[model samples]
Target chain A: MATGLKIKTAAELRTNYLRREMFPTIFCDGCGLGNVLNYTLWAIDEVGLDLDRTVFVSGIGCSSRLPGYINADGLHATHGRALAFASGIRAANPDLTVIVFTGDGDGAGIGGNHLLHTIRRNMDVTVILVNNFTYGMTGGQSAPTTPDGGFSSTTPYGNIEHPLDICELAKALGAPYVARWPVVSPAQPVKSIAEGIRKRGFALIEMLTPCPTAYGRRNGLKEIEQIWRWYREHTVLLDEWEWVEQFGSPEEREALRGKLKIGVFQDTERETFEDRWAALVAREKL
Target chain B: MHTIQIDEGWCKGCALCVIYCPTRALQVAARFSPRGVHPPELVRPERCNGCRLCELLCPDFAITVTEEGRVHA
Candidate 1:
């Protein structure tokens, strides 16, 4: 929503980026997948990525369906193995940009081990993980990213376990870039995604999007605006939180509990998986 | 000047466009699409400042706001 920035025409974007035959997407009304996808395409446009050379990879989930809608070379990979598939693609062709779309269940739940290994290797891929706190494609089951006390179909009495912070996990695993953003606003996410795509090694962008049909109704957020309002109310920038942690009292830090600390958590340079592989190949040849 | 265009066939009437419109220029119309949901309509074109909030928030990619008119009223 930044003013004065060059905005692409809808017709042009649809013709160039989206698969027009797939119009009227299957996402439920008020769902945030559209927002996530829009920000992603905007990011690709901003970074001037060559779509012909970019490959999209995804696993089984609502968010994973993203690749099928875009007019690009993509693999609708198996369940919980998008990163595994993407790593193979990256190893085969280091020059092509590999982007992975995954949901909380697909990325953090069944695929958590693969995610860790992929980050540990510092694979040359950009991961866009949409965490809606529930298995939106599978009937509102509780997901690894579901907040404590969150209500899902499987957790009728409310969830007891704490949520997994994907950004913290990725940063701990030494990803080259990690960021998180709520889907309420597109400006920050669009910019962050663009930056992630430009990074050299593993880049993870966790998007807290709303699944109004699966997750919202049970959580008393039947309205999409309410979810947006909740994001505006319950989220804080990580930089601001860090500043407060450094300068403010313990009580001030305590107030941050349950508040989603979003924004770029880390961005550092590192040799990517392909670089290591190339060195190994040359040394072996010698 | 600004103009709002909505693809009624594409719109699912989630009303994110209607609710996010800064000037209240868009509203959910009573008529339903073949999809059975009422689509949002541009009710007040003159009030729009081309913010594109509706365009960005719209889950359906239904709304598009464009700068229009070369002269002021």
Candidate 2:
């Protein structure tokens, strides 16, 4: 997958993609959300997407605030309903590219039903779901993706529930494009975002971002470096994970436990809802 | 020659660029910016290989690396 993406200087990216007045960003120091935004812009630039014809839709959350920073048409929708609003936009004007920015709480918890139906329907929209373990905006509450035994404001003792694997869920739902990447690495996420935009049907790119202020402060990762290094140490590439699972020794496999698998989970062609809708309209002459 | 620029007003003093710089060209500044955080300074400009990794990893969009004699504008 040769993205052929020309690396742009920070000044150029700021001039081209960002709404200058919006900065400095509201994100806390050491938060990985900014990295996510940077990678998305790179992907957009690589794809040569026309900002005029693109729509950035987001629900209420820290991650959802990303669209507000981009220099493009954006809809800051209600909590947990970014995909719903994005669906309306795509249906109204199929020509316009729709990209959604949603958080773990916004997309997988409050909007879990929306996430399911959207993937099942195979909507023509790209979703960037930022999973930072906890809900950073609402004062570090335990989100659906919070790791088991992870500490949060809501979970004073520890999160008893297992963390949700969003990429696996999207893959199971048969989304045409699904991938997950930690923000510690730059190139892979940028490439995956661009590929998701190019993919025809439902595309879900899950970003594992670090929330140093909310999540890290509560989870023993008090320092910025600790949290960033945590991500680097915790994530295992999907290919490597599979190899370890198949052939590694018991101790080696045990060491892999609790590590998140990051990579492209699914990429297969399928008939999108828009294509079916168009077919139905042509047939019924509606 | 490679040069790095730091936007003091925008930097949050995260030190990510300092920690991630491959060539050790950057260091946390002793002086504080108006923002009251110690923005990174190009302490060893000669060591910079112009990889632009700091530019890409900087969450604040506060760093820009440009090779001298080349116009990236």
Candidate 3:
């Protein structure tokens, strides 16, 4: 337990929440996704979310495989289209809550358009984009999110291109809620995911997880502990970065290295796409 | 009316089950079972809430609740 947890009985996370499997999960030892999923489910239960009315859309990749592991009503879509699938789900049933799960590459790369438009449209969707910095599912190819100078199959010479700050990108595109978290910090992640699950508008919870099999081995931090250490040291909570908010600009975003800032970049009471569409339909009498 | 069992072999005695039990019916006793697992004992049956908190918090998968003429917690 951290020094001051303010240990409350309820956990702000309902532990009884059930999903795809029983309590015992079969994820690999030290797998961060399981912790993230546990937090996600706890959030769902805390918010009293209707599982029947909630739909999860997953794209092709290790992170995308998460939806299938959950019992929630969800669909495993093709590569980089989880957002599109989630969009369709939200479009068809405005009342339902749609959540999209995508890996870093699938989301920030090919699914980039889907993500941009989803936020622009302010669709009622919660996107939990897991950024492990490498393509763990397919033999460790470099990802759009891999830190610059990080080694990957495609980046043996070190990645020349910069990694995208997803929360900033989402905020720029009009997402009502945007935040990032490290998977190891279980409690806050759970609270953050719950916040996303309860929000009525577009929300992004970017979890910076580690791919020990890919990222760790290539970086010479082969052990899971080293990766965990990296996650802890490199990623600073958004609140801590607020004082340094003056360091804002595309140039700074691209040049700044070493410290990976995490937190909710933006949250507003903007009207969601569902509201606008419903109003439009009401007016058009369609 | 109820049936519950904990796989003693897997219990790590995390005490999460004892902490999460809404009714506080389950408590870790000083005596360990034959398998050396500190099993949960129901000290008070009347206050059982049947919320399954014990089941949720058992990190070691070591507790199950079953009751007769009432729902298990």
Candidate 4:
């Protein structure tokens, strides 16, 4: 909870944070990517981050375009390499705060290796990875996080592989901050993102956003209401999930299957890459 | 009283606000905006509770809820 911070209204936030020149974003009518951007801005505002000292880094995707809309320094890096660029920025100027906006395809699929090493090294960065289940910009191809039996252009017959749980992967890698939230609910994500920004290590916030035009139309969730409802019904809070798994009946446990767990999965401090590097330099000088 | 302002230029008319409005005070306007989408209209303003859930859920930053005299310039 970011206490004592005055929460700005949408109008106030827009005037203070957004680049007005980027009016009418490129997101689809029913796409939740815009909501992700909104929640992120709220988080940034709550954290009271100095736009001049913060840098937004993103890869080649619809979600990656977010950095351009924010009135701050941004790096529109190559496909799936946003993390690489962000790492460089962090290493060179540790005083600057780096926030990376990446999509499921761009972050988890094409740049899985970079994602792994970044977390392993515990680089100081906040990653807002929007998981829309498919490659939205490239004509709705099956992404690494696309659920099994889900429909997409590349998976017309239905995807055969299991969906990747990005938050779990981050937790396994010992990320200092890890959370998953659906865009349907705004409050939790805003709070979680703020927490991620304040935490001093690798922080991963996986936002499950609706892709009505891309993923939903093919999966019988074409209507905006339907997709939003699907997200609400399919996602369970982390605490509720644990309780169900521990004490629920067989049918109850079975029903919990395939539902995404949302909430802060982990929060722990660790030695960041920048701190360790500083220590190494000091030791070498002695 | 809270007033709901809908910026037609930015609204894509997804109706997320209308659907998620706790008071059901909003409805998709029959008239389309310049963007060719039906922006939400605050039909029953009296029912609005100033919770601003619509403002928060609107994907497009098209909706703003503000107190009567405290409008942001």
| TM agreement with the true structure for every prediction | 0.94, 0.98, 0.73, 0.98
lDDT of 1 by residue, B1-73 (tens): 7877667777888888887777898888888878799888777877878788888777666666667753211
Docking class of 2: medium
Model 1 stretches astray by more than 4 angstroms: A1-4, A248-254, B69-73
For model 4, name the residue pairs that clash. Answer: none
lDDT of 3 by residue, A85-119 (tens): 88898888778888788889899887888889888
Looking at model 3 chain A, report the run of 10 residues with the lowest lDDT sum. A1-10
Per-model DockQ against the true two-chain complex? 0.46, 0.79, 0.06, 0.82
lDDT per residue (tens digit) for residues A28-71 in model 2: 99999899999999899889899999999999999999999999
Error of 1 at A225 (Å): 1.6
Candidate 4, residues A81-128: lDDT per residue as tens digits?
999999999999999999999999999999888999999999999999
Going through the candidates in order, state the TM-score of chain A alone for each one. Answer: 0.95, 0.98, 0.87, 0.98
Residue A102 Cα positional deviation in candidate 2, in Å, after optimal superposition: 0.5
Looking at model 3, residue B61 earns an lDDT score of 34
TM-score computed on alpha carbons, candidate 3: 0.73
- On a 0 to 100 scale, what is the lDDT of residue A265 in model 1? 94
- Candidate 3 regions off by >4 Å? A1-27, A244-256, B1-73
Candidate 1 chain A — worst ten consecutive residues by lDDT sum? Answer: A1-10
List clashing residue pairs in candidate 2. none
